[model samples]
Target: MEALVDHVKTLAKSCDAKTRREILDQLQSLCHSIESPDDTVQRISFLNLQLAGLRIGADLKLFNILSESSSPLTIDQISKNTKENAVLLGIHRTLEHSYTLYQEVDKDAFTANNVCKTLATIGAQAAIHHYFDAMGPGIQELPDLLKDTQYADPEDITNTGIQRAWKTDLSLFLWFQEQPEELSHFQHYLTMNRSGRPIFLDVYPVLEKTETNMDPERALFVDVRGGTSHDIQEWKPWHKDFIQPQTAKGAKFYYMRNIMYDWPDDKCRLNLKHLIDAMGPDSFILIDEMVLPNSGVHWQMAQLDMLMMAVLAARERTHEQWSKLLESAGLKINNIYTYADTLKDSIIEAVPL
Candidate 1:
């Protein structure tokens, strides 16, 4: 662990600015692994308390307590003015002790820090109002999940509590599909590095604009299980534009994103045969999806494999599994491009014979 930390520190100091940020992000994941159970529990408790405090502060208009004060105000003063219990109000002050807004001097006596003065100027109530508004159902689920440890399935973990809150109540996933601005925010959560450059913003455009760069005599791209929506339009405008052409002739390519993982060998073969019948022998088919590694046991990959099993009775495939799928489909895997940072995710190029 020490060696890993030292290696990350060295990489952070030696790498370029973007590489350094990426390294630091990975280091944060490592830190999460190293934290003691007790420490993790304490941090979760503190966060829940802080969230609760933020919620109550907004409701009682206690955020305005600092605004009304010329300097930092005591819990007694706030309780008396707001008509709330002094003890309960002190809990909020204690929860935010690390933040600059509220500083505890000697038991129950408080003073305004820099953040407090700023909050006062902006109206602390309004400052936290939006956060409280956005945190509705999902925020409440965290405390319960932290308390219950027996539920270990990643799918259940992904489906319940905070994940479900984001999925169902917030409609965050659907919102990203509908809104370009939201899609940008979602992209930040994925791996963005490529050979050393940010490939997402660079190489993505080439894959997207296949029609514009097409040759009239040849097929540019193919979508294998390409249905009504390719599901790539949220971040790839070229994909959205490419699929709309009236015909495959003239600088067009067949594009398939997230299509090959749904079936057993025989069914996948049938799907590919239909695609091959439609495409010219020279045309290329692009498949974007998870291509599991042949070696190494990744817990995340295993969990995702199980998700496919439970939901669709399908499984995530290794490269060998993918090879079989391609052969069965009457297509040959030309090249597999795995993005630099994301494990098991790849873009596969296949051609019909």
Candidate 2:
């Protein structure tokens, strides 16, 4: 019996005794030998399925539907209310399977559960609206452009110089200039949340200089594209005793966030000159923007740069590009604070010297 126990212990020891290198070698060999054509095909199919589900979900306003309900509803009920077919609704229901909506249900009937409630609170319907609204005009013209035979050849009249200019920066700039109301609507959507109240409410005391017995010098966040200051009330609670803008001359730091990237060099320079004329020489300008690095490629920045070009005929700037902009704006860079790892975005402090 003792010998049998000893034999059993020996077998266990042998099983546990594989060296790290040996295990790694075995794993490498197994990985090299494995072929996963089935997995590849399944992954592609899964992505396509997700895309189709999203399209159906958007069309049916599933986020908005679930928002109005306190409890989960079946696919048939959702379809009846939304006027969407049950088959498409079922696809979205399945797509939401991993969500909390699926977990609370004893059976799958597209119940509005905790996840759905959370999504509604986050204004997921409004978010979807924003997404589709941004894409609407562009998506409408694609089919017609594709069908036009005149645009088929690379060197054709439809594809060459005049066509290129119309499709490029000039056309977009003209559209924006002509469509002031539409541009204002877009700006309202983008800048609605960025108010002085939101910025200074919870975050103000920390940013204030505690050592000074004098009232904390308020930072002047000059939104260059600062449309009608609609959200100013949100900041009043936090900065209740702060000096009014008209009264506070030179006692504040100015901030321009996400403004300079939308215009050409000449226009940006003109904008900066106007800012400089308003503020004192001692006042600092803090620019919060993505400062593209001199080296190392960032795919997101590159993509955003292209979008800015398409929409505004503008591009994201590098640190050097920013310096040039500042110079053009009659301001000089005092210091630049770049967050490590996220090297694309930075806080650039400048002064009109």
Candidate 3:
């Protein structure tokens, strides 16, 4: 028993990302296991309200004000900074009660934690506001949507929860186009690397797989979506391709990170068909996404699956699901190199089937 305890202690202290997440998962499970039925329901129910709190906080610049201050801030001070009467201070109650995002030093007083500071950052604020703008309403509509649809799995992106809430036929991405602020925020949200997981290249031998077959006139790598700064480090000066104005007709390897889960299987198939048409004989596709397991799924994975359903009527797929989807697109999975144990972020390498 002592040895087992010592092993757990070691795992807790260690910097190994996989083990750290395992510890967190177990700790979360422990809480859920012992928690009362009332507490459990309250805990889960509050999650629905979290976006509301975050959105309200962002609008009032509450996180900004709190994060900037070195000392604890009273409600009066916060009110003064915000230039608003009777601040709701929803984030303080919602996030602190749930995630300890802020430090409630005393009654009606708060200080910034690391999480609070991140929330104050532009990207995080963008994520908070942009996501909440649609998601908050979508969540509200979801229960009715499910019941109205007779509890069917939402496979149609056209008439989704977000569309129903917003009262627009435009897809989530297209709707953002009309709102520049939200669109910029959406970009900022995409740019943020808050997941704290290893990139696909770390786990997948992408460089090794594609390096041997190089063509000078032809393109090497084309990143469709704007990638992170991490790309600058992993890929050398010659490797990065921001192919605009014209498509790279025959790229050796086309890489995308966390792109597929945004759309349903039909959309994914349609999306892939366009790409497959652009591929050369030697070309391969790399999809960086989470590959969910059949059982014992992590909460983050499960939560994201719920999120996808709520907004886009899309889903995060399991291996079997992924296989069927890709097979339908006329591509075969060469390998699935998973980079994170907790989220199971993987590089699904596919070539012509």
* Leading candidate by lDDT: 3
Runs off by more than 4 Å, candidate 2: 1-59, 67-71, 91-108, 111-123, 136-223, 228-254, 277-279, 292-303, 337-346
Error of 2 at 344 (Å): 6.8
Q: Which runs in model 3 stand beyond 4 Å of their true positions? A: 1-13, 84-99, 106-109, 194-197, 224-247
lDDT of 2 by residue, 1-353 (tens): 79966775566566632343344455555655574888557655675345445445656667568768667777777789889778876766766664344333545455555555544432443333433444344433434544564444221212222223335433443454665654554555455334222322223232453344334555444444343334333433122111123223453445555666765566666666655665664565566667898665466578667555434445788878888878866788887765322334566777885
lDDT of 2 at 271: 61
Q: How well is each residue in 1-353 modelled by candidate 3, as lDDT tens digits?
A: 79988888787887676778778778788879999999999987888577777777788888888888989988788888887674454435545546677888888788998788889988898888766775678777888989989999998887678888889999887787887887887777867754454766677765686666676777777665454545434443233322233255678777776667888888778767766888898888888889999887777889889989988899988998899999999999998898776688888889889
Query: Sorted on lDDT, highest at the top, how do the candidates line up?
Result: 3, 1, 2
lDDT to native, each model: 0.54, 0.53, 0.77
**Models sorted by TM-score, best on top:** 3, 2, 1
Winner by lDDT between candidate 2 and candidate 1? 1
- Model 3 poorest ten-residue lDDT run: 237-246
TM-score between candidate 3 and the true structure: 0.82
Worst ten in a row by lDDT for model 1: 188-197
